[model samples]
Target: MISLTSPVETRAHHWRAGIKLGALCASTLILFFIQNWLFQSAFLALVIVLYLLPGWRFFTHGLKPIKMLWPFIVLVGAWHWWSNELQQGAIIILRLLSMVALANLVTMTTRLSDMIEVVRFLTRPFAKMGFNTRALEIAMALVIRMTPVLIGKGQKLTWAWKARSHRRSGWRILLPFTVLALDDADHVAEALRARGGLTNND
Candidate 1:
């Protein structure tokens, strides 16, 4: 799996996963409750500062996945502009950026194993009550691990299209991308089966 954990070490990396996760949850909930653009902007600026405190390399690495949010941001802004609600739009966009960037920061500084362990510990009571925690843990891990892989594959497909055509790849690559994703999923299923993967009765 391609680890999202940043290579440029920072003090945040040493913090406990549970604590960081807890703070992330609280911050996310707080963001949803805020209606003022001024406060939302302030919170987002603080998040940006937090990203910068880790130095240039770490900041850039953390920023990579956050860039994916741009399309959604643009969509939200356009809808709100058409409705003439720029204040609400600013609040929404700022909140979205702040929350996702903060989550990405946590993911980049924390190990996948550590986050998994944190989830496991938190869900122990439910596990004892008959929930299949192992399946959930495996699902979470695979989602985190495969997300970047899919993103990279999409980029490669886009590049391949660009190399062969004069126009932008745009929606034309969707058919091939869908096929590639299905093929990847088939391979992953086979690999999991080889490892004696989860079943409901497990």
Candidate 2:
């Protein structure tokens, strides 16, 4: 579930992880600052085009995690439609989708170990002070890797509830979602233990 890296290679894959991450940050900041729906929509279109450039398999593989964002998309669209603020909603949703898709694009292309190297570089001072920065590095890796996995679980849980009942699942999925996340965490912990990876001590 935590397979953040895609098998399909792109020119983006050959880019340095630090550069990709830096560009992601810059793009996200730009997206956040712009409130124009047209601009946001353009940005999103560019991201989609980037996804498409790697061919269908890579595009589809990259899109799976992005598709998990539909709930928020629905909520934002509905709320905007209800309040007659569709313009504002369009801007919000477009920004949301564009930033997330770009972030996903970076993760899909960049290797996890390369990302860890970036984290290590950023945290060099902590390591030099005799602090166990390995844990911090691993924690960062887990977050980037598991976020999409958990979101996929949430999407499945939502579908399951919708299939069984007539009402909206809303907050009801929280408990089950938490349980599923914890279960995944347990499995991940076991895997890490098996690899002697859970320790912070140097």
Candidate 3:
């Protein structure tokens, strides 16, 4: 698996996974209560500073996932502009970008095994109630690992569309992207079954 954890280590990498995750959750909740664009913008700036503190390469790598958000950001901004709710749109975009950046910071700093252990600990109560959590843990790990892979595949498909046609790719690549996603999922399921599925002991 391609590890999402950044190769350039920072002080944040030393923090406990549970603590970082707890902080991320608390900050995200607080962002919902904040409606002021000034405050949201300041928070977003603070997140950017946090990224910079990890050094240049680390900062750039942390931002890679955020590139996928531009389409939604543009759409939201355009919608709000049409509705004359630009302030609300700005607040939403800033809040979302900041929270996602902070979350990405946590993911980059924390190891996957550490995160899985944290999830296992959190889900222990449900496990005691006879619910199986191994699948849940595996699913979370797969999401973290596969998101970038899927995004890259979509980008490649878009590029292929552009190469073969004079028109902009835009939504034209959606069908192929969906097909690729389904194919990847099928392959993943087959691989897991071949490996006897993810067990609690894994």
lDDT of 1 by residue, 108-148 (tens): 88999999999889988988788878888888888888889
Instruction: State the lDDT of candidate 2 residue by residue for 1-202, as single tens digits.
Output: 2349889978888999999888888998998888898899888999999999989999889887777679999999999999999999999999988888887888888899999899888888888887788988889888987887787888899999999999999999999999999999999999988988755555
Would you list the C-alpha lDDT of every candidate in the order shown?
0.87, 0.87, 0.89
Candidate 3's clash total is 0
Assess every candidate by TM-score. Answer: 0.94, 0.80, 0.93
lDDT of 3 by residue, 88-131 (tens): 99999999898888888888999999999999999999888878
- Model 3: which ten-residue window has the lowest total lDDT? 1-10
Model 3 vs. true fold: TM:
0.93
Per candidate, the number of residue pairs that clash is 0, 0, 0
- Taking all chains together, the TM-score of candidate 1 against the true structure is 0.94
Output candidate 2 Cα RMSD. Answer: 3.3
Off-target runs (Cα >4 Å) in candidate 3 are: 1-3
- The prediction achieving the highest lDDT against the true structure is 3
Q: Give lDDT for model 3.
A: 0.89
Task: State each model's C-alpha RMSD to the native.
Answer: 2.1, 3.3, 2.1
Candidates sorted by lDDT, descending order?
3, 1, 2
